[model samples]
Target: MKKKFILLSGLATSLLLSGCWDINEAQRMYYVDGLGIDYKDGQYEIYLQLINFTNVAKSEYPNPQTVPAEVGQAKGKTLEEALFKLFRSIDQKVFWGHMTFIIFSEEALKDKNALSIIDTVLRYRETRYQIWTYCTQDSIKDILLLTPILNKSLISSKLSTPLDTDDQETFVEPVNFRNLVIGLNEPNHEIGIPYVTINKNWETAEQQGQDTTFIGVGVLSKSGFKGLIKNDAARGMQWMHNRTHRGEITFKLDGDETDFLTVTLEKIKVDIEPLVKNNQVTFEVVVKLNATLNGLKTNVSEDEIRKKIIKEVKKEIRTTYKEALAKDIDIYRLSEHLYRKNVKVWKRLEKDGKIPLTPSSISKLEIDVNQVNSGRKTFTGTFND
Candidate 1:
């Protein structure tokens, strides 16, 4: 009787384990790694970066014709409408579970209702909040279509590189939807996403057999792109966020001579102090950095190089900070300073303006950079040439 009871219990357990509740197979649908959204004229345009599985599988085998990816686009009155239209045109079911990027076109950001569109993406149950987000000075569609000729795998496989994230070396940092939402909800902070611009030579892109090409950055204020920020301005944005990891800077050594050096930042800290007196809003931004000299093409004394780096870094920081102030972007958390230091004034300021940023309020900018080490002299690995 005991053996019979045991058999019945085993049968019951097996019956409960039968099927998938929300199972999805990779083969059944096409994986989307990047998405671009743009608003032009009167419609919303959606671009999807689709991965080719067969070519990706054949990447190990040498074949030049195996292009890594393809692009698809569609337009509609609403975001979902445009997306569904794009899905219907594609041969396979579009799956965004593996998606890593989202790029917004300048036009899309122009909408006063831009935040509403953002709300749609975040509110979706299937959308992953951790995916990297960017803005493009050019059309979002063009940026999504960029695939290098040598890219044998596909767009989906290529975006995994760490370069996309903001480090000391890069001016742009990969800001995701989650970070944006968090900043928006915070009492005294603003958000900025990295920007991209399309490479001009499309025929060359096709002839060269590459998938996509882009450059520069898209700047955002409140609802949309305020304008495009390039070169030093972008660098300033990185400094404001205190996100520099590994960056290169050129310093003037002597007359008509300049030396290039790369530094890997070890630590960064920023403090914002705001004061209101004599009916004037005064802001003091202080930034501190500890860095290692990682690269140097021209040899120089350690002491000399250290001095040059500090001087150049100070100039760069001041210049960039000024640019941020000009744009009133507040890449640094100046609003947070006001809230923490003087809550009553911040409340009054908020009640006065829809866009709560002011350029004239800045009174001082101070930057300090300390050189830690000049990296190791000997490489651990053997180089066979």
Candidate 2:
């Protein structure tokens, strides 16, 4: 009976000690939603965007106004040091498990130690591999300070959510931490990250709003910060890289500046073939597109419009390829493709150290456009009529 009494007493004590021992109250923790990294003057600057649950959870009706998140900054010689310095100013333990996105300043990427910063982030236990990554030429602090205009969620949501969520599709593909790491580890060490900028417009004296806009893509080579590809060039890279989904294209009809045609992309398929002969390499790119007419101001049939689109897509692809080659930016990832398909040739080239291949090495490029649906038209007028 004494042994039984002792066992019961010990069980009670253990239960009391184990219950919620490490549990922190919700009010005592800061949930970081976004992280921004910048480098200047041999120092690393860290920016943390913390979501305010209290403000986000408000139940008020009729235009409730409350800031959803707040930003904090700190600087040090290393990433860890910067983060620790940031923690010094906050009373609550910063939780990073909920982080949705990360932004790196262009200046940070220009630094030779940019990859080291990424390695540091991967080492953290709380950091996630799937977090979206972006690069911006603007101030990292300003990017983090952007507040959501029409949405109630945090401003960082714009960068975190998939680009296809909106009605209009994005040109550049989204890159995550895992993809960035993989690219950096590739033989060529080339990668492209989506670029973001602020769109500031003053509407009225009482109301001035600023929103975040994805401008284009920033390319990174082994040397770092190659350049930026925007608009048509970015779209062209997406096609060659087979990263395009659904996006709208606007072009002039019959080379007339006033007559415009806008088409919505339905599907795209790209085939890249790498051929090796006598220690020389050449690539052939074939692009197939399925699209529909969204709007037309030209007096041409659907067949004619299809031909125009095919030509335009081919032009875009060639222009982008040439530009990348001139700048020594391998956005098409031709070397990676060769390594995957023709291993022996790629290894031989790598052993030789610095393969002498140019953009002109792409000998052939063909584009085939198919109009799946022309849509119903209220007015039927043809140039032949």
Candidate 3:
């Protein structure tokens, strides 16, 4: 009788546990991979790109191209409100658990209260803090539509992502939402985000016989869109942030001033020190880099080339750092470092009104770059030849 009672009770408990909590299957709903937000004329618009499962499945040797997923937009007074408006149109319950990318319009970012708008999305239990956030001067809708030609060429490729770990240094510095928040919450630090501009380069690439295209970058300070950082300035930002994981660096070759020697950054490290004097504040930025002799027009020995490389690399680092500081933007988080290192000093400066220490204060700066390694010799069949 005792055994029978115990078995019956266990069975009842098992039946109650078999509820809908664990039954949500992959096929039951749409998975969103990216979300775009824009603010215009006192209204908010939200964009969602949900993955199409049918296109994701079926792996034949020569499969047909997958159709691009549709984009959904909702508009309202706030981000969540706008998203909810779009949710009403979808059939399956839309799930953002898999979502990893969010783009904000430059205008949206300028609003002093922009944090409140983003808070709803970030505070959601289902949303991941690692989602990459981008700021663009162009319309968020326009930016979304400007997919890379190569990515669109392949049916299986994604248009936008959290941050492509492989090409992080060159194209865009993907800032996850959590990192941005931390930088913002820090007392003395201000946050910087990548600003993108879209053009007809996608179609131009196909017409001009090229597989890839260039997207321009805009700079953003605490005060909305500061200005555009075209070509070198944009690339310089990557160098300053120590985000140049792998990219070409060009300089005049030894004994051949007209010819160019291009070196590729193999590794890099950035360190910073903030010094607060009696009244003036100065920052020391140290960048250590390693590169290989990727290309050269002259036959200078490896050792000779390495010497010239160090001299040129330092000049490049300082020039870039100065230009960024001129814009009053600390693409490098010097303020954040000062806050962590000595909060008391920073507070003292602020209290005495001796230092103009606003969240957006421009830093007085210095830069130092050391080249650790130039190139390697392969022993198998090559030796200084």
TM-scores of the candidates are: 0.76, 0.89, 0.76
Instruction: Tally clashes: model 1.
Output: 17
What is the lDDT for 71 in model 2? 91
Global CA lDDT computed for model 3: 0.59
TM-score, candidate 1, is 0.76
**Cα lDDT of model 2 by residue, 237-265, tens digit:** 75665566677777887767688878887
RMSD of each predicted structure: 5.7, 3.2, 5.3
| Candidate models: Cα lDDT each | 0.64, 0.76, 0.59
Clashes of each: 17, 0, 0
Model 3, span 22-107: residue lDDT tens:
66687988878777877778898788877566654542222236554667888898776887789899988778777766777767
Off by over 4 Å in 3: 1-18, 57-65, 142-172, 197-230, 241-244, 254-257, 301-316, 351-385
Residues 154-196, model 1: lDDT tens digits: 4333233435433425556666778888766665345666665
How do these models rank on lDDT, best leading? 2, 1, 3
C-alpha lDDT of residue 371 in model 1: 53
In candidate 3, the residue pairs with backbone N, CA or C atoms under 3 Å apart (3 or more residues apart, or in different chains) clash, namely: none
